[model samples]
Target: MTAISRTGAGRRGVATLICGALAAGGLAAAGAAALAPGAAYASSHREAPLISGTPQYDNTDVYAFVSPDKPDSTTIIANWIPFEEPAGGPNFFQFAEDAQYDLHIDNNGDAKDDLIFRYTFNTHTKNKKTFLYNTGVVESLDDPDLNITQTYDLELIKLKNKRVEHETKLADDVPVAPSNVGKASMPYYSKLRDQAIYKLPNDAKTFAGQADDPFFLDLRVFDLLYGGDLSEVGNDTLKGYNVNSIALQVPTDLIAESKHQPIVGIWSTTQRRNAQGYYEQVSRLGNPLVNEVVNPIKDKDKFNASEPKDDAQFLKNVTNPELPKLIEAIYKIKAPAEPRNDLVDVFLKGVKGLNQPPYVTPSEELRLNTSIKPSMHPKRLGVLDGDNAGFPNGRRLTDDVIDASLQVVEGELVGSKNDLGDAVDKNDKSFEKYFPYVALPTEGSRGKTAKSSADTKSALGDGLTGATSENTPLIAASAGAGAAGILLIGGGLMWWRRMRRNY
Candidate 1:
């Protein structure tokens, strides 16, 4: 979100050389001039028209990074069902039972998935007689009062030459962390979330549940970059929203080809069962905003359905991106030259020598170098600011993707150097520091009452003290119930405290 003076055409002269280097298979140096588009963050909340209508099956975002706590492992997180209102009730957000949420890894960088982790969910309602999500104050995931619940199956499918080479069920009937209904219903939401973190073989961990939408940006770009006058910038549009998230952590050696070739490409897809009972790939995401910002309206949905191997069909969109031209028209800034091979390196192929595979098949997937250790102090700007441990290597929860994307699109690579951003620098809430790094979902009771336990307890205490001796027993009982409700909400405080310690 910062601005800087342009260095002029002195830098622009290198574009041709970059293209030449790419053609001559010497792009390692040329591609190093700028950060990859993988760091250019775009929130795909209802990005395409068709996918917009089906939020449950829509892929919102995908994040990959080396596990900070356990540096030997890699973590991949994917989200769905964006912009969920905390108060939206009766039928709270849930994963699509008929959909297969999959995370794909192209270890050999052939633009084909070598490994796929597929998650399928099943919804359960304990009481058909009640309209409530919980029949009573829910104490635990398996509590009978937690009427509506869900469990999921995790399958690890290995592939070769686009054919299923082998498939193994990694987890069966794992409890999904339920939605945070309210303080009264889910006082121990964090405990429930911890219970949902199921351990997999080989020191891997998996979690599926509602979470604070980790994406933070001013989505007002649809309104001509904030009413076309830059008046509407700086707002975190997704402030209070939530999303259903799935997170997986595994050993780096498991997905990488070898320590000699440690890079891996990652992406996610949603396959929904159609009318004919066939599962169709409806949504796909790798880099933050490829489909949302790069592809045009006509190709957005198609990009979602297309595979990385077939990415040549959409090369023109990247070479002649429309965003720069829009900036040129609106703000009188110059667009980068066409046939942007630099963009190809940023978007399709990984940045040379950084995260790119040796024989990468020019595709759109988040290519991560697993050998890069986690940063001791991460910079929000990621690789642009020399934090190789962050985005462009692989996105972390704290990476400032929107700002990076804006600067890159405005010609940071082709020498039109300037700091362009939406002014939204960070998420509304701090991300968790441990595995399954997303923040907890906003409760349905959020903003309805005092969040602090001390406040709630004091208010209930005052009520009890004001009661007459004749009615003291009744008031004390009511106060006891109120205090119990306060304890339930206090559990959230305990979770935050724990997070702070781990963080």
Candidate 2:
């Protein structure tokens, strides 16, 4: 199901909060366990019921931001196949050829997609008779030894003025970068990844391949979400993880309808032609985690399948968020109250002047203001730290969403008064400083689960400090808003903000 049209509803309301950057959603909340692998605490892993069982097409996370280095273009990256173990050989992870993965832009913002960027992958096995992914050291994406390879085609379709126009071959037969097997197999991994970057006819640049997963969070946050000792919990759980990413870098005006109002809302979704011969949205994400922690189980699947227009049913959940209440109940932390128009305006609508499109609807989509110039000293904490070009504006590769999410949801403002964080401060690897900005995928041979942090025992003194939950008083602060990292809201959506969380 694609191509729905709507006129303009309007842009977000004025700065009713501290800053106009935060949208909504985080990597995953620190609490609430789920019945499925990706269902835990509302990160974009296996966010929905049906897609949790199918990781290949489960939309993990979508990041949209104006290129920090190249501010003239907008970078949109959509990831899939999460919690990837680098060494899963024989058959390494690949995009599902049968599924259609898409990144949509709601330029006019009536909760309908005005511009759509779709990617369909084709996995080709050169020597199907072979058991190995590559018979020998894979020289290139086109190397004959590569027994199995994948390539994709990209299309930019649009619904404008009630007219549907299709651009069939924005990029065609584009070779996807191969999995980083090992140094022996992929000696020049950088070259191999760069080779896959295809410049589109629309003057956009595209790259589809395996890359390091940029998301960072303390996974144990689900279990009271503590990790003072690195050994027990502070380790980066996604250290060796990899993902199939479809990325595009295009001029702001190419996607957004207006030149003056460069604000545009974006989201990514995956769908497959089902048994009934109907295309069904299996995974949908904009801001982040709205499904995992925000919605009741009964409505989670429905939420995934439905459109942003239907978000009103779930509006109550955000207006009166249950996660903050749950956190306050268990952790005895004080959070903001309901009718959280603050959250509604930031999460559903864009923060007024920053990312909120001139004409928009209350929908779940990553909104970016192309006008916000990139920051050289980019803060991983994003808007909270006052880097307007960071996440919640439109997530950059280095944005520390976990911390930002925790601070905002806890009712803290973007100030130094309260320090709420998961302790896993950044990504496993430093992201590349250029286009296709995510770091290369972890080598298959080197992949493994994260271990405890090295500083674990030293700081906490063998669980003594870690056990001071009751002794440490929650810091108290006003609900005055602060700057935010841009993210949005949805089942798989991730909206970002900076805040104080006092105990």
Could you estimate the TM-score for every candidate?
0.81, 0.78
Show where candidate 1 strays beyond 4 Å.
Answer: 1-43, 447-503
lDDT of 2 by residue, 1-503 (tens): 11111121221222312111121111133222111112111346765677788898877777888887778889999898988888888778999877889888877767777888889988887655446676555667787656688888888887765467666558778999988887656667788898998887657799999999887765654443332112344467778889889899998888877787788877888888888887778778776545766677777777777777666766565666566665555455555655555454455566676777656667666778887888878777676566777766777778877656565555543221334555566787888888899998888764332222222223223223223443223211111121122221332232222222221
- Shift of residue 448 alpha carbon in model 2, Å: 18
What candidate 2 gets wrong by more than 4 Å, as runs, is: 1-43, 161-163, 224-233, 413-417, 446-503
**Mind giving the per-residue lDDT tens digits that candidate 1 earns over 353-448?**
688788878777888999989999987778776777777678999987766655565567777664555566689999899989999999988434
In Å, residue 270's CA in model 2 sits off its true spot by 0.3
Best by lDDT: 1
